[model samples]
Target: MQEITTIGLDIAKSVFQVHGIDAFGAVIVRRQLRRSQVLPFFRKLSGCVIGIEACATAHHWARELEKVGHEVRLMPPRYVKPYVKRNKNDAADAEAICEAVQRPTMRFVPIKSPEQQSVLMLHRTRQLFIRQRTALINAIRAHLAEFGIVAGIGRHGVEKLLDLITRGEDERIPPAAHACLMALAAQLAMVKRQILEADRRLLAWRRTSKTSKRLEAIPGVGPLIATALVASIPDPNVFRSGRDLSAWIGLVPKQSSTGGKERLGSITKAGNRYLRSLLVVGALSVIRRAKQLGYTRHPWLVRLMERRSVKIAAIALANKIARIAWAMMAHNESYRTPLPASA
Candidate 1:
């Protein structure tokens, strides 16, 4: 039997498919296993390099495999796509993973620890509740609008609308309609409470994490952004430089340069949308303050504002903030704004 040197695992909820190859790249093991049998099968094999797509259960399996002395490498699913020979099925994906994992230039995702994943879960849960709250608010507003009842815009306005729904004083709203709106209103209240609790938990995390605290010292970063970045980015050193980190966040401009002429356009917007949005919001906050104060305090920002529109300047500042944040994490240093040189 050819010694199985590499195994590509395509993981699913109930079953898993595996394609194993020998040192000379010959197919040695092509098999499927139930979820319950996966660990036992791998335990029988000698320690070998395992490759899996970086999705759903990949991190958990990576940790499990590494415990038994196997070298596990996870590749982004997109990077493995080109390796598929014919069809896109479990076997083909497993084969692609096997091939991609061995490529010298293939990038691997950092295996996140349980703690890091837990923190990310908190962020995700909070975001979910917040979104639910927004949808509920919009529903309530739309329903009220049908009866010529309209509240002002914003959370305070939502409160006014809720009060009207709760009081049941408006004769225009039929009893059946009132009951339905009240139910939605009740749900909205519950979601709001959940969101507030989530915020408290995130704040607690922000207070305890030293790196998160350091991130908060940056101009645009608040507790939310600070804690979020700490949770999302498991290893800053994965990137070779701060610019790479910024690019990874998709804060850099999209470029189409050919034949020595450079063409640049809007941001790539390729990476974590949540993180990018938070950073852009933070940048907008900074820009608002800078605009009000005439940018005297941030001379560099002033010069940037002169060259570009306020929105573009804000994005550029956000890119800088991302780079600065990467530097802070990479160096284990706190953020300290560089002072303008004296004339």
Candidate 2:
């Protein structure tokens, strides 16, 4: 009807809402489609601009829509919120998405390919198993503490506790209590094994990814961080500059400025928590090495560490690393550390 020029779609597990407007921005269609009807519905319409929130299933649908000759744009859910007129509903959200996609300055998310999503799946699964392993270890520790069978910190310590429990050396641990701990210990071992398998798979993936291999050349970057960045950010050129990329990664400071006064606080910590944490962890490794070498190799980091706390310096370094990574990806170059000029 009225040759719909643009459409906004609100996607859910079983149903989807659609809002459409003509070239003149007049409302033309409002409808809902069941999951099974989605492709058939879109197949009936001519190619048009479509907007969707960048949520769980958005990328898959975007790819499908694109293949059908429709232009799809995905915006972050928060960016679409401001366009909502009143109470939130599926229809309202669709309308907001429709409006948001037309804004010239509205940011959009890159649609990742199935291959990119697969690599990310590996990382996510690995993270889940690691978390489960940690929880099991903590549970074991807590249970042992009740019987005064405490061990020192870290995973090795947990293994020691498990050894004692398995040997039945302590009368303090009743047979019944020990059995429960043994079950937990078994789970911990299984989770650890799963995590290791994930790691092996990631490493195999990294070996085949030229971009991941290039990213690994940077200081403090290893297979894990390299593969993660390559998977999560399909296109680094979407950002205008390295600083923009760092900001997108939420490595930049939060600003609260008014009346032409500049006020900056801690980092916003707004985007991609997993990537941000990986960058920070990489930065920490660099910092640790720099400290051991008496900061001889990294002059800038030496100056930064002298003026700021280790935590702040680590964040700053992470921001710098993210920027460097963006440049590498944008320019298709491997990382190369700069050398100080001759006196």
Candidate 3:
């Protein structure tokens, strides 16, 4: 039997399918292994290249396989989809992954460290609580509106509603409705506390990371965005240029060019939605500050605001910010302000 040189592992909750090929591209093994049998099976085989789809638990398996002296490469599932000959099944998917891993042009996902994963989890949890808080606030407002009791917009308005709920003296609210509102208010307060705790933990983690601290120097990138970018991008050098990073973050315009004509539409929005949203929100903050101050150091942004809508300008600024962030991370340098053009 020839020695296997490459393998594709399709992982699941309790079962995993493995397809392996020898140096000459001949199938050497194709079988399903129970969850408990996976490690022992790999231990008996010689070290080889392994391909895994970047999905839930993929990183954990990749790290484990690497610890066993195998070279693990994680590819986005979408990129491997094209290699599937037909009939999507665990066996077929494993075969496709095996083929895709050997392609020189195929892009692979960088394995994230446990710490990075933890920080991301923090971000996700905080976001979840924030959404829940918003829902609670909206529900409370809607319920109160039915009784002809309305508060103004923003925190002051929300406070007014909360005061009414706690006082339990508003004749407008029926006892039943007041009880429900009290329950929602309690949940909202609890979620708010959770969000604040998440923020505190995130900030604590950020202070320990020099990269996150350095990223904070970039305009429009606060501790939240800085920490997110640092945790999300494990290796900035994987990107050939700042533009590549921007494109990966889905800040680039979508292209539909054909023949000799060029057509472009909105941003592809293909990559990390969280990062994209953070950058855009940060950009909007910068724009708002610039408008209020009646000036900005970047003349380009000034010109952009003069012609383009604020939202469009915000997107463009976000793209530029993403590129700047990539350059800083890739080069291990601080953000440098570009000098104004000589008239």
Name the top lDDT candidate.
3
Full-model lDDT for every candidate: 0.90, 0.92, 0.94
Writing each residue's lDDT as its tens digit, candidate 3 over 1-343 gives 9999999999999999999999999999999999999999999888999999999999999999999889999998989999999989999999999999999998888999999999999999999999999999999999999999999999999999999999999898999999999999999999999999999999999999998998888879999999999999999998899888888889999999999899999999988999999999999999898888876576899998788999999999999988888888999999787988898
How well does each candidate superpose onto the true structure, as a TM-score?
A: 0.96, 0.98, 0.98
Over 213-236, each residue of candidate 2 has an lDDT whose tens digit, in order, gives: 999889888999999999888889
Clash counts per candidate, in order, are: 0, 0, 0
Q: How close is candidate 1 to the true structure, as a TM-score?
A: 0.96
lDDT of 1 by residue, 1-343 (tens): 9789999999999879999999999999998999999989889888999999989989999999998889999887878999999968999989989999999998788898898888788889989998898899999999999999998998789999999999999999999999999899999989889989988988987878999999989999999899888888889998899888787789999999999999999999876788898999999999998778777778888888878998898889899999999999999998787887799
Quality of model 2 by C-alpha lDDT: 0.92
Query: Who is ahead in TM-score, 1 or 3?
Result: 3
Model 3: pairs clashing at backbone N, Cα or C within 3 Å: none
Candidate 3 accuracy as lDDT: 0.94
Candidate 2 vs. truth: CA RMSD? 1.1
